[model samples]
Target: MGLFGPSEQEIETAVNAALDKRASIENPSVPLSSQNVLSFLGLDATSSAGERVTIESALGVPAIWAAVNFLSGTLASLPLHLYKRGKSGRERDTSALGVILHDAANDETSSFAWRKYIFDQVFTGGRGVTFIERSAGKKVINLWPLNPDCLTIKRIDGRKVYQYKDGKRTVTYEASEVIDIPFMLKRDMLSHYSPILSNREAIGLAQAVTKYGAKFFEGGGVPPFAIEGPFQSPGGMQRAADDMDTAVRKASKEKRLALSLPAGHKIHQLGVDPEKSQLVELQRFIIEQVARIYSLPPIFLQDLTRGTYSNTEQQDLHLVKHTLRRWLTQFEQELNLKLFGRASARQYVEANVDGLLRGDFKTRMEGYARAIQTAQMTPDEARDMENRPAKGGEADMLHIQGATVPLGSQPIRGIGDNGGPPLNDEGNNSNAA
Candidate 1:
């Protein structure tokens, strides 16, 4: 310790040390040395999830892409609707909410774009974030999807808040103002589960396999000649041998399979084909594993190794029932919570999965026929689903083809009979007559 404050150098060092400590305490940083492992994903040392899975690793790997793409693409293609339930318990399309949610930004982004963004975020990071621009009454007016990685969640004074770091300054948003849809990552109500972080091993193996493949192909093939018997090589001799190897490679690339080797070297084939290495099987097995992790059908990820003619329809059903259904349900519940306040539960959001469940032409027609016959759906309803215009009077009407009559009475045979008499063939007869 120095009297009358420390020396200039000491003061500078102390201040610098203090600042470094304070900076670390204020804003934690991901270290640079922990940046890359496979030249793709980085396992950060300062992550709350205890592991940082890089986007490059997730997107760089094929299996991961197959799963993520299928999810994002499917969600974007589906039609989502907003419905309002009145006091009478009747629900109808709530267009006002629908307009905003469909586009979210109400500008350049499409409804599919909004859904795709949300779907991708949810599946990959297990958290989908959006900033809700609210009216004076706190009703949501505009919505913008925020980068989940940049968001920091907090709970203050029994109220949850989000601190959005943009550039230098931080912006705090109330829980109500931010749509924080988090999947159950670790029972922490705020932070979410990251699929990439959890499935690092599988993804890493995939990366390794992909790299091995690339490396193998990049080398063209194994060296065609192996040095046999006693041989000695000084610097000049080694250089010549390397030149010979380069020449052999050049020849192999030019489709000249025949190679002239030096006297001491004979052509020794080292054959380990992809089939023998079980790479095809490994690729397929990895695909299935990824599918299971995402609760997706292997067929959905373009894995047709196990697909069959009869099981195709069943696979479609499985996709809707198991995979998309769960995701849609989560979306519905999350939208309900975020868009509609928890206090007053009048309106909720729903995705029209019926469109996804529609089978092929014949199957669809049969199902529609049954629905129409059972009075479960009107002719117009069925036709509307098929994108066809209404056919007129009977198309709008609901019919039950029981061929029975009114209570305590029988169905009249013709227009003349009023629950009394049957008409003679082509002739009108009635009790009223």
Candidate 2:
């Protein structure tokens, strides 16, 4: 029992404190906050959390919101399963690590809730942190996600520790207890560069241009008015100019269709051509630029300027293979390393990208038909892929069109009905003239 209390929790805490004191004294706390992290690191203070490229700022930009939403939403939609190595090469879903990852809900949050949160943070901040709470025998029972920005990684001597800063107090965690997933490695291999930070200048340009457009439309894109009337004295001319300016502004504010001018004064029209301004084309180019920053196809960003029927499918393939593939691979590797121990080679995580790869109904059906006819899979398996319940009797059997015993059982038949070898490129058979 602890000196201060008879409770087990208090006793445990006291014992941990003694042990920690004996090992290595805790370092003096260095205060941190989401707003000052960048400043602490000698970076531009304007780039700190809630300042530049923040979740709010990101969502405020339509292009950024669409890119991040598409990426994170797609990840959260996949069903993660816990799998184990069975006899031979077959696998089954029953591992403890898999169970923890497949549904990471604790007493506080649901699987979907934390999964979406994790992906959103990972893509935005290029990092995600989850603290592990283990039961007896070191079995993980609950995991809690922490704000990536508030959490900092620091190495002391040879050991690494994680610090979660809340105001002036920082709580420390050993590296082994926190699952830190980095989107991509930086120079030191411990930190990552945020995508939003790298693209801040471009995003700022887009925002500036948008604001300019808004103000331009507010004035109806009209230019300042000019006058050609004469006044006798300098003061008289100034007063006349002021009177004319006030009258024009009041007329515009009241939305009057007509304005009165003196007999000698004439209204000069200031003209602007929308085409010469290149506003539409400039906006289109900027949207395309934003899409390229995230490696997203222009179509995904709703920029369909260059879209064509012939190239649409190709673009889809490009996104799946080049863009999504890279992100998914990183996620899978991190999951495999953290959830399943590094030593467990055969048991690893994989995403079913077939959802993105699925073609039109006819094409998909034809491909499945080929698989079934070649004994690659049963008809029930094909149906199961389309989320249809398997028929208990007929669909279980594998069949081929060759009138054979089992698939590939009979030798490939001769080329033709002549019961002879096939003709060569020279149009002559070896056995016949």
Clashing pairs in 1: none
How well does model 2 score by local distance difference test? 0.68
lDDT string, candidate 1, 1-433, tens digits: 3333222234334444555654685655523232332222222322342333455666777878878888888977787777777876647565666776654454666778877887788777778788888789867767788887667775699888888877688899988777666645454465556777567777666666676677666656652344443346576556756876787678768967676656766545565666687987887888877887888878888888778987877888888888788777877787788777787566777777788888779989999877776667788889989899988666766665554222224344776556556765656564444
TM-score of candidate 2 against the unseen true structure: 0.73
Backbone N/Cα/C clashes per model: 0, 0
TM-scores, in order shown?
A: 0.79, 0.73
| TM-score quality measure for candidate 1 | 0.79
Worst 10 residues of 2 by lDDT: 2-11
| Every model: Cα RMSD to truth | 8.6, 11.0
Task: Sum up the clashes in candidate 1.
Answer: 0
Task: Estimate every model's Cα lDDT from 0 to 1.
Answer: 0.69, 0.68
